[model samples]
Target: MPASGPPDQGEGKRRPLTALEDGYHIVTTLGSAATVLCATAFPIWLSRVRDNARALSGQSPRYARPWLYAGWIVPVANLWVPRGIVADIHRASAPGERLPHAVNWWWGLWLAGMPSGTGLMYAVPTDHVIERAYRQVYPLLAADAAVVAAVVAGVFVVRALTAAQRRRGVDSVRARPTAEATGRA
Candidate 1:
């Protein structure tokens, strides 16, 4: 029978979360702004990255496969690509057995920011507007930003606490030992 008093009692003490988690969340939240920012920034970033890649490889810009081109330019597909890439990046950076909090933060802000920013920039504008209508839009957009900021901040707090718990050697607060397991451990 496995012996235990507290969970993770004999497992080597876990290290505190590295700064990477905090930095990753911050960068991701900003990057999620790319959905709107990307409407303006992605094409530029993509162009630069592509140009750099081509220059390094000495390859001419060849026609990309139709699906590849479509995946990037199409609305629904574009969202998925960036999201998947961010998740993959988070997965790569996280320690084994640790949940990828970075992925959660990235996805939450990315999904929320995209629709919120896009709605503010594209949907709210009208063919005809009253004089003060434009002025009102900015405040609405500011409110959206504030809400997103709160959500992102909340994500960071949860992630930080989880990391601290891990460092203190509580493997998982949600885990419950079975009757036999509890007696043995």
Candidate 2:
């Protein structure tokens, strides 16, 4: 049987988490999953704001709500479509003002990091040699790190846009005009 309990914390000392079978991997996986899940919500909320702000300002969103979700899931198109969405939101919200530097930085990180993250995540080793796997881990780690950074940048993008909308006095989700209000059935 496999030795039970955390390994090598000394007899009286508490064992490390790794002592539990798969504990470290499970924790890491859960952390990564939670981080990605939280990151996913940023765009959804931002898109709602983007469209609402546009509608309030008498403009149409660059893409439909579905397109915003698609932009994240689609491969090559993700690179530009999402960026276009942000740019459109900025144009609508800020009008003549210069977009905050955060917008450009967020877009740049996303454009660059996403491809790198995908490449690293999808690249597989030809051989099972331990050394090769160890060597590969560094680049994979770097790419994953970049992906995390890009996720953080996404939040900054949302913040800047949200702040811009506030500055434009477009802070609320302006309700759609009713049929009666618009004089149509």
Candidate 3:
């Protein structure tokens, strides 16, 4: 039999979204934005702190601050580059202090989730088919789970290291000593 409306190709015709789906879309969009901000800010903030800590301690980090930001944005290098930069920052943030477990957890979860979030997983059908629909959905779910874990672990690492640095009396990594601090007009 012929289909009713415009051809949907293999998929069925689309229907108007219910209020729940609409609300879900809105929330996910906002949540995604927040996720992006946190993801970017985590590396940059840590990198800056690490840089300052290194400068104050008379030692240099293997990963520069700019690489911390740009590495994640670049292609072919993002796989391990950002994680390496963050690991370096994690190490340098607190001189002579052991890297926290949260750092390792974050790296592990990030590596686990990276493939799921990238071109490896495509959005597949959400139907209840055993092989047809689930192969795609499961990966996305796993990816989301891993990413959430990574973000939480990152929060832990950032808070712990930031507090550690402040307790050790490291200067702010804002690229300038303020007039009040410098005591200069």
Candidate 4:
């Protein structure tokens, strides 16, 4: 059946994104969300590690940023936090390069997937089999776990690339000759 609602006239109103764009968005959004969750979780886990180390050494441990916890609980903030996390990931990955590829991927997915997912979820389902299957599967954690894993992998790839860049930067700095030695005549 054809769509019944009024047409969308937003930017690029001539037409909506193609199927490729929709797939890209879904995958990217999943990756971005996974990355953000992992990044935040890793830091918190490290903080716990720090606390344990400190306790073993008879020193006080520092806590992880409270914002990490805040991001998970707050609604609007959750969206914005992921963006910031991705930006930070990009920055951490490449000091001067354009935002990491993951950031672009995340934005692409989020822009396309979010609205589509919301619409698909809310729109009255006409197809019996699809509606029944969706209802049956949607509530299961397995579906969410698969999505989460894909997203996390996307974030991980970005992180790996960034770490490589940082390593190169460090190596170049270490390779530079001392001015005193270079000036010897």
**Which has the higher TM-score value, candidate number 1 or candidate number 4?**
4
Tens digits of per-residue lDDT, candidate 1, 1-185, equal 11222122335642333344345446545745654663555344334333333333344434333423454557877767644433332232232434455545654655565543433335332211111223465744654675567456545634543443334333332222334445564
TM-scores of all predicted structures: 0.32, 0.67, 0.69, 0.37
How do the residues 1-185 of candidate 3 rate in per-residue lDDT, one tens digit apiece?
Answer: 12232122336655444454456456566766786777667766766776666765566777656777777767777777766765666556566777788878987898798765532123533222112222465776787789889889988977877766665555577434545455675
Q: Candidate 2: give its CA RMSD in angstroms.
A: 9.1
Q: Give the alpha carbon lDDT tens digit for every residue of 1-185 in model 2.
A: 12443233355664333333345346545756775776577666866777766775688886888877788678878778877888888888778877777667777766666554433234432222122333466654666676667767777877887777766555457735545545676
lDDT string for model 4 (30-70, tens) is: 75566577666755543332333333334332323564466
Which 10 successive residues of model 3 have the least lDDT summed?
Answer: 125-134
Q: Model 3: clashing residue pairs?
A: none
What TM-score does model 2 achieve against the real structure? 0.67
* Segments of candidate 2 deviating more than 4 angstroms: 1-24, 118-133, 175-185
